[model samples]
Target: MMLSSMTLSRKYVILGIAVAGLIGSLTSAGAQIQYQTGQNVAPVYEGWMHNDDGSIDMVFGYLNRNWEEVLSVPIGPENNVQPGGPDRGQPTIFVPRRFTQPPGERREQCVFRVRVPAGWGPKQEIAWTLTAHGRTDKAVGTLDPLDEIDTHVIAENRAFTITEGNKPPSIQSLKADPDTVTLPGTVTLTARVTDDGLPKPPAPQPGSGNAGGRGNAAAASSAVAALAFMGDASLDCR
Candidate 1:
């Protein structure tokens, strides 16, 4: 039976709509990595920092799917750097559990942040990847002179810079309840961290132009550091 022209046109239109929808869905899925329990997303380079030591430090971050899932990936296969490490010793990433987002928010939280030595000539590339339970996602960054990262603009002390006399936060104590627990049971973890870098508000030094109004102003960042928390995280105790 020969179909009418109108019926054939309708059929073609319906098929076109279905194809378009499928394409859109695929594109969206590819745009952002989806991670879940036993699965992980890719790592992204936020930017680089210039250490006091002349070497550039590559800052990387990643996402974890489950809210209660913690993760700890080392600097090796699955998540590694080319040409090997300078032995700066990348820490086992400590990713906090995921959390709920409020309305109108659309940024993925970086549960993990780490820095590695980067200065292997122009071709040096760092690849941060996550693969678990048969799923994999990876992100690569290069230190090439002509690479996408504007290393020139990322001058010394541009964003995050550490200099002499800088001290990191200290852990007073860390405790975990029911360290050894049966299956289907839960454990509680707690940490006590403190930083003494903050200085006590000092009295104005009586400067003519109020230059000393801001105590330790010289140590303060020239520009406010902007940080954003995106979505949630995964579950793999670091």
Candidate 2:
């Protein structure tokens, strides 16, 4: 009897340890999978703005679920925009999720635009569809009165405030040193950026903690042009 009791106690101890280890392993796996690869990309219809030529530009961006995966989906049945064509200046390469701010929103905004003539019906819709990682998602664009965005809205989304007469910095003489490159080769890009230097930083107050540093607005503008292409392939921007 004594021997049987000892054996039963040992068995219980081993079983408990195994169960605990299994639970711990599951928790570790769940945490590690938070930003795992092979996630899908979702199309985002940012908004629309009226162009000076009486045309409306429907802006779009994408949300790549994996923080570590950069997806290249060529234009085709899997990636397409409709109500005109499968391609309307949409990006073929979907980058990973950038910074996470404003909580729960992780999207690359204003990547591209599709122009609609001025007379386009307000109820008309343009759909941009993308399929990645075996999942398909779409973003629909319409002239929804609530969805109209102006320069101020765009600037706010970009985390910068633009006052009147504050024009966006421009990129001049942007070119890749070797316009053509063979595979496994690198190309250098050069560009000159100009800005009106509007929206100057606020003057340092008596003690607002020594005036937080300000970034170069022109440099930030120049980074927007960093998304370039080589031949027909979309180059990944690091």
Candidate 3:
């Protein structure tokens, strides 16, 4: 579907903000190189949001420079948010570049957020620093008017419809039996999802040239079946 001009502009604005937040330098040669492993991760400051309760959330994400490696660094000096603490609810699991995205939209964006009080000053800052592959980089958050983000920004970034009553499906619970296993072992997974049953399937008319008695429902079901699992869930044995 074609994106509205407003949506496209907002998306570009967020991207510009992300680029401006990078705080350290890296070798220009590294940008041309794609490695399967042994690459650094850069924390990204996506933007900030104004909450209804007068609090603001500083959104953040990451870019794992590697093309294939997935690193798990526990919260500490290596992965930290400063001024308030070493842990600001940031992620420990860093996955490789999102190759699935279209060319310009690949870097992971808006993965998590750190909330700041409404009284937070415009000059105040929150810094998320990450050290990986023998290098360090940071993303700083502030109350810059140009760096504010909202639901429309997110909808545009995710390429999802933002109708008044439209809501995305929620995964209530997802669990894997045993949560871990040795090599050559099978793990059972269960997920419970809840939805509003939106965009109900089109009704079939007597002779509209539609195949199958279910009309569009069959096609919808097929599409859902094909997309039953929406993310990459891989176990790394290292």
Candidate 4:
């Protein structure tokens, strides 16, 4: 009886130690799996930028706090415009992050409107929300009437016709539709106009930098994509 009691005590001690060790291992494994989460910052509206066509652009910037790619930062469905519903306004934007910008730093001018509709008046506001990684950010901008002066005036006033960044825009695919119209009437014209100063779009051009334009809504996305290509240094901006 004494020997049996002693054996039972030894078995209990061994089982307790094994159970403790397993708990410790699990705790250590959990520590290894856990990590820090990053913040997805909202875009900053840079205000209305003027275009030569008597229209203005809504310039914006953003920051992705994570070091990795924050894919598909989309505008939320609840986001909308007043008096005309969402369709009367711009569509939701898709802003993704790449290595072009340093992690956690604001990517300035990441996106911009080629042109905002005219007659928006001096103080119109649009609220937009972008969501990514289960995080949401909202930004609002006043479509302030463009307070702009002629660039030619500034350059000419100083007798500086050409500056370091001065670039002459190209008129690509310029055409007058209905080559044979009714005698001396108006014919529909179509063309792509791009400014050569900024980053080129992802699409390759024969031999050029970025292209810029504020065309019909149908062509807006394509134009924006081409403009993005200009940022590629491999394309040789020229």
- Per-candidate RMSD, Å: 12.1, 7.8, 14.9, 16.2
Query: What are the runs in model 2 whose C-alpha is more than 4 Å off?
Result: 1-33, 99-105, 174-189, 205-225, 228-238
| TM-score attained by model 3 | 0.63
Candidate 3 least-lDDT 10 residues: 222-231
Question: Residue by residue across 1-238, what tens digits does model 1's lDDT show?
Answer: 3568889999999999999999999999997764435555445565555566766666555545544345566555654544454222333443434233223322243333344454545555666655544566765655644433333343222333444554554655377787786756666656555555533434445445575554333333112111223212223323
Where does model 3 exceed 4 Å of error? 1-32, 98-104, 174-191, 197-238
Model 4 TM? 0.40
Stretches of candidate 1 above 4 Å error?
1-35, 65-68, 72-76, 86-120, 136-138, 144-238
Candidate 4, residue 26: CA error in Å?
A: 29
TM-scores for all candidates: the values are 0.40, 0.69, 0.63, 0.40
- Give lDDT for model 3: 0.74
lDDT of 3 at 9: 91
- lDDT (Cα, 0-100) at 122 in candidate 3: 96
Cα shift from native, residue 229, model 2 (Å): 6.6
Candidate 3, 58-131: lDDT as tens digits: 99988788888877777899888977879888887887656444465646778788988879999999999889
After aligning candidate 1 to the native by TM-score, how far in Å is the CA of 90 from where it should be? 3.8
Model 4 clash tally, residue pairs: 13
